[model samples]
Target: MAAEAVPAPRREAWERRTTVPLVVLGVVFIVAYTIYVLAPWIPRGPGSLLFFALLAAWVVFVVDVIVRISLTPRGGRWAFVRTHPIDVLSAIVPLFRAFRVLALLRNVPYLQRRSGAAVRANIIIYGSTYAIVFVYFIALATLQAERNAPGATITTFGDAIWWAIVTIATVGYGDMYPVTAEGRFYAVFLMVGGVAIVGTASATIISYIGEKVSEVHARHGNSGSAASDQEKGPIIEPPGRAIQDAIDEAGAVDDEHGG
Candidate 1:
């Protein structure tokens, strides 16, 4: 247990340092991919520069994956790699490389603490944050892969964004859907991711509300006990007598004489 705790903190620190840089790299990859997609509209030299830059960013992602695996403090590197298939797919597929940025969304294990409220806040924040990123990146990836394919309805970035929002919301209006293999693969990821976001947010909310309700009930219980104690006054030990109201001796004598 003690040894296991060591790796989590180190992994968290590494994640904090690298997560921002990974997002930046993802943005750069996005710009490069945009140029690559619009290659016909630009000069060949600038497009080639963008392509090479994109490749360099991919190299960075590859390095990031290797470092993460090394930092795991376990010998299951191959199993980890197999589980994180996105790392592999992003390295091999040019268009899919930008999607590797999504890995940053998954560092919650290290960021979470024992506080339920804090964990709940993290859950909602992470869920909302990743949902937004996925919508944006998945939109671009879907467009790049589907725009030129046969029977592709997502021809414009506008359509792509719209489709992405609908799909990520799990609305599926049927107005736009992926035609090619890459687009469909990305869509599947989007659907699953959307469901996960919703589920996390819902569970966190329920847990938070439950915690609050329990706290309120506990306070009420304490207050009720306090009121009962006040009604009874403070308890005295058996060796001492509790004070009573003073007797009216004159009035008692007058009442006895009248009797």
Candidate 2:
């Protein structure tokens, strides 16, 4: 008797339900950060809302990260933590003071396989991240430089935010030029960094477009080849096989009749 074959172990399916909350949390973070950065335009009462939203987002992000880590493969958890200590820190770090933005990089692997969607989503994410960081740094530098200067314009958080936006966008209308030496230095840095950021954004958009085009071309080529093969019909059997079989049957019939 033949020996029975052992069945292969089944691989686990990717659990979308487990990851859905994490993805939602990431989206919430993105949205809350956007609102936080734009809080200058909101009224004081509404600005508090932005702060509360940020707090909520941070909490959600921490919970999501913990859930994700829990769901990760046992060996993968250690490897990820070893390589991404920042991610671990972001989860536990103090609110509004930690380098939690660095946690965005952790999503790269999950997004990478999605190709077109990944490219577009990354462009948006990185663009937002760049904007948020640029605003924070510029505001910090501007406030530090101009806060004590006589007759300096950037007196409040809103003014500083506005200045940061203008500087980082390179639309410096000179309506709020930095008067102090440190402010001037920051301005120069912002100008250069702004240009680099814009260039990087353009490159990302172009690369995404190129990836989309390549995907379309690949799909078209595959479909065309499949259609062409289908039109050509099956090549395994000769065209004359049916007729040959019929002729052989006829001959057999005649031989039987004559016999």
Candidate 3:
């Protein structure tokens, strides 16, 4: 008897849903974290909101990875695993400080294709995504380091958020510092990370400027072509007036010779 036919593998529905939620969660987390870090004067409830929002972000990230792996083309999984070994560990990574947040970086391509208002919207969305990830990681590191230190004022979530902002901005305001050894180590890491973030922002800005310049150049070129065509009118070359004049002169010469 013939073996039962194997059913074709189907793409996961969850994968399709992942993109929107990932983007939304990234934005929410970034905003919450930013407010938590930058505005310590704000009450504790907002910090709690930021914490829960980060948790939700991790859940979304996990779902997105599972969906992506499940929907990945057959035989593509091994290639993906080989190329992105981090994806395998994404499931088990700690929600608070996971680097999996970088996975949402895929939206850059989509951001590049948009135009006018759409492009502006994408820029806002992309910026928020990066900001959220950056702030969340900074807050997590700062909190872990600053907690339980002698005379450490950064014990509260708000203080931690403030430290994160200062750290990421590379302000290094000596007012709040990590006293514990672990906190100091984390601070070193944060400073390095801060430099990288700043560099990335600069690069992104340059790329956006280049894109705008190219667009302007294309528009100018098209308009110049259109204007030149309008000014020159239709391109009909009248029969050669110079050649006719030469022919008439030759005939007069011949008539004089005959006379």
- The CA lDDT of each predicted structure is 0.75, 0.64, 0.64
Per residue, candidate 1 scores C-alpha lDDT tens digits across 1-259 of 3333333456557778988887788888877777766554765353477657776797987887777778766755556666677666666765456655655555566445757766666667666766776787788888889998999999988999999888878899998999999999999988998898878877887887898999999998887877876686887655423222124566687899999
Q: Compared with the true structure, what per-residue lDDT tens digits does model 2 show for residues 61-142?
A: 5765576566565546655456556456556543222334434454568556666677667667766775686667567657
Q: Residue by residue across 1-259, what tens digits does model 3's lDDT show?
A: 1111222244336544554655566567656655655566656463476677756766766776666666667656655546555555545444232444455555457655756646655656655565666566656656755766678767866777788778878886877778787677667766786787777777667777888899999998887777876686788655797688889999999999999
Note the residue pairs that clash in candidate 1.
Answer: none
Q: Quick one: best lDDT, which candidate?
A: 1
Worst 10 residues of 1 by lDDT: 238-247
List the candidates' TM-scores in order.
Answer: 0.67, 0.45, 0.48
Off by over 4 Å in 1: 1-24, 34-40, 43-47, 67-76, 79-112, 228-259
Where does model 3 exceed 4 Å of error? 1-127, 151-153, 228-259
Q: Which 10 consecutive positions of candidate 2 have the poorest summed lDDT?
A: 1-10
Q: What lDDT does candidate 1 reach at residue 246?
A: 24
